[model samples]
Target: MTREVSRTRLNMLRSYAAHDHRDNFQKAEMV
Candidate 1:
C-alpha cells in the first residue's frame, strides 16, 4: 500500500514539473 501511494505521488510530481516547464517556456517566448 505504501509503495503504491509513493508511485502515484511521484507520477503527480513529474506531471506537475512538466506543466510548470511548459508554462515558463511560453512566458519566455512571449518576451
Candidate 2:
C-alpha cells in the first residue's frame, strides 16, 4: 500500500514537472 501511494505521488510530480517545462517553453517563445 505504501509503495503504491509513493508511486502515485512520483507520477504526479513527474507530470507536474512536464507541465511546468511546457509552460516555461511557451513563455520563452512568446517573449
Candidate 3:
C-alpha cells in the first residue's frame, strides 16, 4: 500500500514537472 501511494505521488510529480517545463518553454519563446 505504501508503495502504491508513493508511485501515485511520483506520477503526480512527473506531470507537474512536465507542466512546469512546458510553461517555461513558452515563456522563454515569448521573450
lDDT (0-100) at residue 15 of candidate 2? 100
TM-score of each: 0.94, 0.95, 0.95
Candidate-wise lDDT, in order: 1.00, 1.00, 1.00
Q: List runs of model 2 lying over 4 Å from the truth.
A: none
Candidate 1 wrongly placed segments (more than 4 Å): none
Tens digits of per-residue lDDT, candidate 3, 1-31, equal: 9999999999999999999999999999999
Residue clash pairs of candidate 2: none
Model 3: weakest 10-residue lDDT segment is: 1-10
Q: Give the per-residue lDDT digits (tens) of candidate 2, residues 1-31.
A: 9999999999999999999999999999999
Q: For residues 1-31, could you state the per-residue lDDT of candidate 1 as single tens digits?
A: 9999999999999999999999999999999
Clashes of each: 0, 0, 0
TM-score between model 3 and native:
0.95
Tell me the lDDT of model 2 at 10: 100
Give candidate 1's error at residue 7 in angstroms.
0.3
Among all windows of 10 consecutive residues in model 1, the one with the lowest summed lDDT is 22-31
